[model samples]
Target: MSRTAIVAGQGALPGLVAEALDAPLVYALDGFAPAIPAQTFRLERLVPLLDAMADSDVSRVVFAGAVRRPRLEPEMFDPRTATLVPRFLGAMQSGDDGALRELISIFEEWGFEVAGVDAIRPDLVPGPGVLTGEPSAADRADAARAAEILAVTGPLDIGQGCVVAQGLCLALETLPGTEAMLDFAALHQGLRPDARGAKGVLYKAPKPAQDRRIDLPAIGPDTVAQAARAELAGIAWAAGGVLLLDRKATLAAAEDAGLFLWALE
Candidate 1:
C-alpha cells in the first residue's frame, strides 16, 4: 500500500487534502487546531515522528494549514533532535519561509518526498479571469496596486493580502492575517468621500519567494462574507498561486453580495 503522511496544521485544508489523497497516514501537530482528529505529536517529537513514518513505509509528506512557530525547549529534544538544534535555531532566526524550507529539507533528508497539496486537488487553484460578478475599473486599478505592493513586500517575508480603496492602500495584512486586515479596512472605510461608495478590493497573492507546496494564500466563502461586511467592492487573488475553498458556495456568495471575485494572473 502506498502511504503518504500529512503533517497537519490548523484549518480545513489539511482534512481536505487528506480526503483527496485517500486515507493516508494522518499526524496532527499537537496543539495545532486541525479540522480532523489524528495521531498528534508536538514539534519536539520530530525524530519519533520520522521513525514512525519510516516504519509505516511512508514515502511522501505534504504539510497543510497554518501554524505559529513553536518555541522548542532543549529538554524536550531527543538525542537526534538535539543534534539538529543549531540548524533549527538558525532557520527560525532567518524567517518563516526559511524555517519552512529547512523543515522541508529535513523531511527530504529523512527519505520522504515533499509534495504540494495542489497535487491532490488541482481545481482549487483557479486560472486568471473574473470569477464572479463584475469589477469596476476602479476595483481593477486597486487590484493592480495590491499586486505592486505584494511585489515589494514578498521578499521581506511579510504577510499576504492587502486592502486598497480609491487607489489608496487602506491596510496591509500582517501577523494577524487577512481577516483582521479586512476588519481594519472596514473600520476605517469612508475616511475619504471617494471611498464611501464601498469601492475597494481585498487582494491576495503568494509572496514571490514563498514555497507554494507549504504556504499558498487561500480564500474561502467566509472570506467573501467578510469582504462583503467590509463594504468592499471585491476580492482579487493571484491566479494559480492562491487556494479557493468551497468553490461553488464561495462564488455564489460573492455573486449574491454583488462582490466581484477576480483571479489575477
Candidate 2:
C-alpha cells in the first residue's frame, strides 16, 4: 500500500490538507508545525528523514502553510545535507521560487512524487466570480492595476501580491510578506492628499513561472481583516491560481468587513 506524507507547517491549511487524505503520515518541521500531533524534524538532518519516509512506503509528499527558511550552519549538517549545501545555498540566493524548486528536485531524487494541496482539495481554489460582497467599478479597476503590477514584478522574483488604492500603487509585497504590505498601505493611504483615506483592493496572484505543485499564493479570514484594517474596498486574486483557505470563514469575514472577495480572471 502506498502512503502519502504531509510535511506540514503552521496554520489551518495543514489540518485541512490532512483531512483531505486518508491516514496521511504527518511530518512537522521543527519550528513551523501543524496543529495536529506530528513527528517533528529539522532541516539540517533531512536525508535521514527521507530515508525514514522511504522505509514507511511513503511515495508522495505534500507541503502546506507557512515555513520560514532555516538558517544553516556547517556544524549542524548531517553528512548528506552537508554535501548538498552548495546546491541549496545557490537556490536560496536565487529566490523563494528557486529554493522550492531545489527542494522538489531533492525529493524526486529520493524517489518521491511531490503533490500540490489543490490535487487533494480542489475546493480551495474558488472559481472565477465574486464570492461575497460586490465589487465597485473602482475596486475592479484597482484589481486590474494590481494584477498588472504583479505580472511585472513576478518575473523579477519580487513578490506575488500588491495593494492599489484609487488607481494608485500603495504598497508592494516583498520578503516582509503580504501582511506587512497591507500595514504599509494602511499607513500610506491617507498620507497622500489626492488619495486621502481612499479605499482600495488587496490583490494576490502566483508569481509567473512559479511551480504550483509547491507554493501557490493563498489567502484566508485573516486576510479579510487585514484588508479591512487597511480600509480597503476588497481583496482579489487570480482565479484558480490561489488557495482560498477556510472558505466559509473567509467569506464570512469578507461579508462582515464589507470587503468583496474577487476571484479575478
Candidate 3:
C-alpha cells in the first residue's frame, strides 16, 4: 500500500508534520492516540518499530518534535541501542550537524528517505517583523546585545534564549530553559526598582550549524506568555532557521502581552 512513517519527538510540530505528510505516526508513548492514529511503542523498542515499518514496505520517514538530548543512563540502554551507542557518542563528540548528517546516512542505508518537519510545514516558519509591534528603541538595543551574547553561547550547545536589560545580560538559559531563567532573574533582583517598566529582551537562535532535523529552535504562544510574566520587552529569533509554532496565535498573544517579536535577518 506504499506506507510512510513519522517518528515522533515532542510538541505540536510532530502532529503537524504527520498531517502534512499524510503518514501514520509511530507513537513512542503507550496508549496515547496523539491526535492521530499511530502505532504505539517505547523508545527502547525503536529498532523493532523500524523493522516493522520496513517490513510493511514503508518508503519514507519524517522526523519531527523536540527530542531532548538523551542523558546517559544505564537503565535506558538496550542491546540494540548499545550497538549504536559508541557511534552516537562519537558523533556527539564531533559536532551537532555532523552527528545529524551521520544519522541521516544511517537512515538512508536502511532504504528510507529522511526529511525534517519544515519539509512538510514551511508555513510554520516566521516572517521578518516585529510580529507583535515595533519594539521601543531601548528594547531594540537590548535585543541587539542579547543577540551578541547568545551568539557566543549558542555554539557550545548550551541553550538558545537569553535575556538582556539595559545592555546587561540578565539571564542566560542553561538547562532550566527560558521560563526558569526569567524566574531566577526576577527572584535575584536582577532588575532595579527604577527599571521595573523597562523591557527585557530575549534572543533565540539555532546553534551554529545545528542539525535542523533534530534541534530546530522553536517559539510559540507559551514563549510570549513567559516573556510577559518576566516583563520582557522583545523576542528575537534567527530569520531562516527558527520555527514559530502557532504563528497567528503567538503573534496575538505577544501583542496582547505588550511584547515585541522580531525575526532577525
Candidate 4:
C-alpha cells in the first residue's frame, strides 16, 4: 500500500490536512487521532522518521496545522537538532520567512514533498468583497485607514490586525491577538462607541513579504463574535492571502450579528 504521512501541528489545520491528504497522521507531541491511527513523535525524532520513511513504501508527506515555534533552550537540543542549531539560529535572526524556507528545505532534503494548505482547501481563501452586508461610509473609511496603518506596521512584525474608528486607530493588535485588541479598544474612552455603530472596523492583512507557507493571517466566527461583543463596525481582510475559516458560516454569523465583513484587493 502507498502510505503518506501527515505531520501534525497545533491547530485544526493539522487534523484537516491529514483528512484531506488521506494520510497516516503523525503527531508532533501527544496528539491522538481517534478516527485514524496515528503515532506520536518528538520534533528531534524527525531525522529518524525520515530515515524510516526512506525504507517504507510511503509515496508522499504533507504538513498541516500550526507548529509551536520550537523553544531552543540548551536542555531541549538533542543531537539531531544540535547539529542544525547554528544554522537555525542564524535564519531566525534573519527573518521568519527565511527560517520557514530553511525548515522546508530540510524536509525536502529528507525526500518529503512539502505542500501548503492551499493545495487542499483553496476555496477557503478569501476573495475581494464586502462578504457580509455593505459597509457604511464611516465603516469603509475606518477600515481603509486601518488597512493603511497595517500595511506600514505589519512588515516589522508588530502585528497583523488593527481596529480603527473615524480615521484614527482605536487599537492595534499586538501579541494579544484580534479579540483582545478589540476588547481593549472597547474599554478605551477616545474611540467613539456610538457614532460608527457597534463593532469598530478590523483590518487584517499579511505583513509585507510575509511567508505565505506559515503565519498567514486568519479570521473566523470567533473574530466576528469578539467584534460583536466589542460593538465594532466591521472586519476587513486582505483578499488573496488571508484564511477565512468556515467562510460561508463565518459570513452568515457576521451578517446575523449585523457586522460587515470585507475582503480588500
Find the candidate with the highest lDDT and give its number: 2
Residue 169 error for model 1, in Å?
A: 1.2
RMSD of each: 1.5, 1.3, 3.2, 3.3
Q: How do the residues 31-106 of candidate 3 rate in per-residue lDDT, one tens digit apiece?
A: 3335545667654444666677788888877766655445466576678866777777787676455566666766
Error of 2 at 79 (Å): 1.0
Candidate 3 runs further than 4 Å off = 1-3, 29-37, 69-79, 88-105, 192-197
Candidate 2: the clashing residue pairs are: none
TM-score of 3: 0.83
The candidates, ranked best first by lDDT, are 2, 1, 3, 4
Clash counts for all predictions: 0, 0, 2, 7
TM-scores, all candidates, are 0.94, 0.97, 0.83, 0.81
Highest TM-score model number: 2
Model 1 per-residue lDDT tens digits across residues 1-265 = 6589898888888888988876788888778868887789877878888989999989999988878888787898888878888889999987677888899989999999999888877888999999888888778888998899989988988788899887788899987888899999889886635734547899999889888788888898999999998899899999999999879989999999999999987
Comparing 3 with 4 on lDDT, the higher-scoring candidate is 3
Clashing pairs in 3: 10-65, 10-66
Error of 3 at 227 (Å): 0.9
Better of 2 and 4 by lDDT: 2
Candidates' lDDT values, in order?
A: 0.86, 0.89, 0.72, 0.71
